[model samples]
Target: MPKVKRKTKAKSKGGIFSRFRDYISQYMTAAAAGVTVVAIGLAALFWAGGYFGLLGEQVSRMTNAGAVAMGMDVRRVTAKGLDNTQRNDILDAVGPVIGSSIFHFDPHAARARVENLGWVRVAAVSRLWPNSVHVSIRERRPAAVWQMSGTLHLIDENGVVIAEEISDAEYTNLPLIVGAGAPATANEILRALRKEPALWGAATALVRVGDRRWNMRLQKGGDVKFPETDISNAVRDLARLHDAYGILDRELEYVDLRDPENLIYREAGADETIAG
Candidate 1:
């Protein structure tokens, strides 16, 4: 009789309530997984039946309507960096976004449409809080006027056509490039001519010959035939010749600088070629 020390048993920690909670948790977890699978199957069925797009569109419309009801509709659109690009063009590119819900407006599509314009080099479109949309853009800088097929087009530094059918009086200071491939190759010769201010000032237009070489139409009334290669050196030599012997000042029919070592010219009324 040791006072009956082992007579009583210890109670279980957490008792029956803990076990009940665990059982309920497992049951609910399995039910939730079953529901998720059913939802996934329904979604796949909708996709296979070609109703997914329509369902998504309906959901989007509902969401947009709800947002508009909450005063999230676009009321004003602001634009920046719109020098050469017309305001109307920007508005058209963004579509009828003003009366629509700001949350439903697609900025990427608007940007793409804006960038499709000839003058817009790059564009950005975005929503501004609850009731505004914003647009930003950078425009191409015109480098020259290209003349082809009896039409005039404005071109940028990279020879990308900015605008077509331009008037003759517009941008009179920009150099005119002639022939089919002239715009693509005008930068090299134009840059070389720029180094020789006198030559650049005398130049009326640059003509691409056979898409290989260039011939400069001079303001003084003659043409200068340039070699296909070593254009910079040839231009420098012509500038030197002009400075030394007044070669460009004379009344000449044409100047041929195709040969690096020879300078040939023909007088306005002479048939013979003169070498200097």
Candidate 2:
């Protein structure tokens, strides 16, 4: 053979090195983008942290700045519908954010604290924006002054005791309820009495007799016994009788309306008398 004229096939080196360089370039570009993103994030974090304070303080400052930009600083806190609750109580519930931004102030949290107050039944707290916080409250009206264990309690219509150790002068207009379990049925009896406005006005106290029926003490004097069943109708009947004949004005000890067929009465000093 003529000097073994077989030539080895040349391996193409350009394709391999080109592919390798392209892969390195792609990795470099990705790394550069990742580094740029991290740098931007760090710069933002540092700016917020250094200009403000720690994380919490930083967030607070930013929030206050935004609120100030929008003109939401709390300058006045106005509360309405306050009768029995003290001003300091409400102010204490609102916390110490008087001069701070109202946007960051939590209305819901402030409302809960106000609702916990003894006189507040339903409280509505809202931001007035730009300079004020408004609190509207619905106070619990005293439905009855309940006497338990020789202590009087101011109770709402729902039988919830609003306050204890309150002076009688504070709740002189409320009806007095006496005996155990009287608070639970006080509203019902009072509502029934309302059907007869004259009777309702003339009533002074309600006593739960035997935990079954009610005995109403009149402003004039004496007591009116009401039956357990159809108590409302029984009260109406007594009112009609009082209107027709000045029966309640008479010197009677007790007027029994328990029996629908007949009424029983007793003279102030006499034993017992029955009327039909």
Candidate 3:
């Protein structure tokens, strides 16, 4: 009988990956050491370049390039809560980082620029991850027009100056205040006047006198003088008198409420006095 021919087994040729795994396992520690040495050398080179200031120009370019490649650049800028602040001004404040990296942007610096604008009262700048910048601004509201030293300035309720050299035609309807310290004390007088809608509506302006007291100008052509102390009580009394007797509706030149206990009124172009 002929013996059966035995089939020879084919020699196995491991793939490239299998060979690579074997190589890495055998020299794993040595490979790690080599990588560490290369990293140290690169770090040293960067430090030397920075110490000599040779890396400043290249560093920014490289950072920007890398950031762009990594999709970390600013792709959009948005402004919120803008009323009188022009859109161009807000864009100018954020112009520096329009296409730059959000990582390199300074939010504080941007916020300061926005707040320096004429209408911005409070501003906040922020970076959205990967590619967006957001700026929120609170614009100053014109509460009154303050006249001092022959100039008019727009002021907010908190006594802060919003704009100077404002035109009367633009803000003709707002309450007008005159005097050196009028802006600072304007809110108090305005608040007191709000208690009496009829009186407040009939009035036009409030002038600070000697930085101590106030003089209110009526729409119908008269002046109302208020005392330095107990102003609220004085205002209450005036409101009561006006409501009960229609005192303000009369043709009066001036009403002196400086003395809360006494109601003094003088007619227009009249020497006689009317008291209540």
Candidate 4:
């Protein structure tokens, strides 16, 4: 039986071509994974080195050059409603515009920057097609001269400070507001005084008392103590008294209108007396 043992070929796992194909498939997969890792590492390196930003800038420059060649670049800038806002300031806020692509200009951002200026109440920025950019702004109106800590500032009607260190002569027509928290309450008294042209014209300064009420200093060396409530009526009554008896025209020290039922005043040298 040992002598009769027959030789037989071992069962084949696969054909030679199949084995070669498997080797190539494994090799390709490893190579692909290595390539992916290398690509990610290079991307991180480029980002860390700011190369991505430079590349983006270069691409932008090229795009801008192409746009310029197409005659879509900004060549001029025009602004309206400038008033107190400097033209150079607007140009600076709008960023680089000449020879830049008009389509790349951000109008909303430019408008926001322009509106941040002290005098600009509102602003609009637009790209004029083909070659121009336009900016329009409305300036804040100077309502009063707010004096704080010996420095003068221009304020708008809404009590917003417009500009600081302003010259007194330049804004002499504006009513002067003195003391702390005067700017916040100036509008109401200013409106009330405006109703009486004589009083408004004679007012030199409006001083805030305890952040609650106002004491009006007159140009003729007199003061009017205003009530915390009923400011409009108090101003009207004072104006009426002035019209009838020329009380404000007199050489008076102060007029106390704090009491709604009684009007009291004092001459420069006399004691205080109740008005009839």
Candidate 5:
């Protein structure tokens, strides 16, 4: 007699996680996605409430209205350097105190307008209570008059060109630095001279040469050459010679310090010669 065939149960291949793991993982992932959505919604709600209005235009209107209610009479507006016409321009950019709230005023724009004065390197602005506006300024200290591209312009220590129209009378004492990136180059030359009081007083112009060489021109038009290698030694050696012989007191063309073995110079009224 034929008996009824019985079905056998299949064995799991990937441990206990083979069957229900997929559904469980899918549910957990869906839950994590839901949490992220909620977090984003809350952040957006806060940003909108702060910058915009929590309840439509009501909050915005209140904030702006509070500032408007404190408008000033503008009895006095004071700014420095009115002679350069920058004061008026800056004041115009800042607007008047009357019927205006300092909260809405743009100090950054006012600063920019003041900087257009050419001499003003930086500017500070403040609101002086209800009736007046106060402003302070910092002018750029000219480091040198740079000769670039066949034209000369006044420059600050940071290589920023200050003005093209600075009269010599206003900055006659400024150094004359020539060649590319002379402002940065001058810093090193000036630093070296600062170590010796004699050179500090007599060093005038710094002339760049050969892209890697520097020449220090004294107040009397005597040039001191520094080779790219061991340049400091050259300067020290020259300074020592100058201290010993008082070479600067005589007529000379230049002092070639680049050669350590021998020092050469051109007599002020005579030909070039080697000095021990």
Candidate 6:
């Protein structure tokens, strides 16, 4: 017998593989567009950065702005740690930084330039921001004008030679030191002389005899021999002898106070000033 044929349903041609391929195509296109946009953004950023001076040679401009902002003008610098003359000298040293951007100026170079000056023992410099620089200084205090190898040494309390600008008349009050280690010798000499300001004030020059001995010449004329040991005692005795003999008058040629007990003296003709 003929039976009614049931309609069979057919499956769709597009499966999971086709759906995956379509999704992959859309994703690839979107990724490509995204990558292109990112590349363009980076290129524009770099170009703008270069044009607006965000890179290379911007330091020079920064330096100039810094100088102007910090009040590094020639006139303003006078009120700082340096005098007008010293300021001019500093400007000359930092000439390159005068109109430079603060970022461009080499701080180390500037410091080195200023430190090379005569009186600058310790120097410091820093930026005040906006438009100013602050400078601080520690100057060397002269202990005495030292004389070494016949050359004058204007030294400090630490025995460092600060300057060679010797003026015989200007520094007449400072003592002269001779022989080896004159700088160190000057220290010892000043120490011994403090006990007797009358003698210390009268001293015109102090000569170091050998590396181990000390001799002081009076302002008027005469030598004071200080013993290697008990130098303080020798100085006290010398002061007493000066009081006794009136050594300041320049009558006696030399006095040997190295022998504290037996003070010795010699006239201009006798020659010998100290024993041993």
Put the candidates in lDDT order, highest first: 1, 4, 3, 2, 5, 6
Candidate 6: where is the Cα deviation over 4 Å?
Answer: 1-79, 83-85, 93-95, 106-109, 244-250, 259-262, 269-276
lDDT by residue (tens digit), candidate 1, 208-267: 899999999988788999999999999999999999988888888999999988999997
Q: Each prediction's TM-score against the native?
A: 0.81, 0.68, 0.75, 0.80, 0.59, 0.62
List lDDT for all candidates, in order: 0.92, 0.85, 0.86, 0.90, 0.71, 0.68
Q: What is candidate 2's CA lDDT for residue 134?
A: 87
Give the runs in model 3 whose Cα sits over 4 Å from its true position: 1-58
TM accuracy, model 1:
0.81
lDDT of 3 by residue, 67-152 (tens): 98899999888999987888889989877786787788888988998898878999999998989999999898888889888888
**Cα displacement (Å) at residue 262, model 3:** 1.6
Q: For candidate 2, lDDT tens digit of each residue in 115-181?
A: 9987899999998866898889999988989987788989999888889877767778778899999
- Give the runs in model 5 whose Cα sits over 4 Å from its true position: 1-70, 73-75, 80-99, 112-117, 194-197, 200-204, 218-222, 229-233, 260-262, 266-275
Model 5 misses residue 118 by how many Å?
A: 3.8
How big is the RMSD of model 2?
Answer: 6.4
Which ten residues in a row are the worst by lDDT in model 3? 48-57
Instruction: TM-score for candidate 4, please give it.
Output: 0.80
Best by lDDT: 1
Candidate 4 stretches with Cα past 4 Å from truth are 1-40
For model 1, the stretches where C-alpha displacement exceeds 4 angstroms are 1-45
Please list the residue runs of candidate 2 whose C-alpha ends up more than 4 Å from where it truly belongs after superposition.
1-73, 200-202, 219-221
Clashes of each: 0, 0, 0, 0, 2, 11
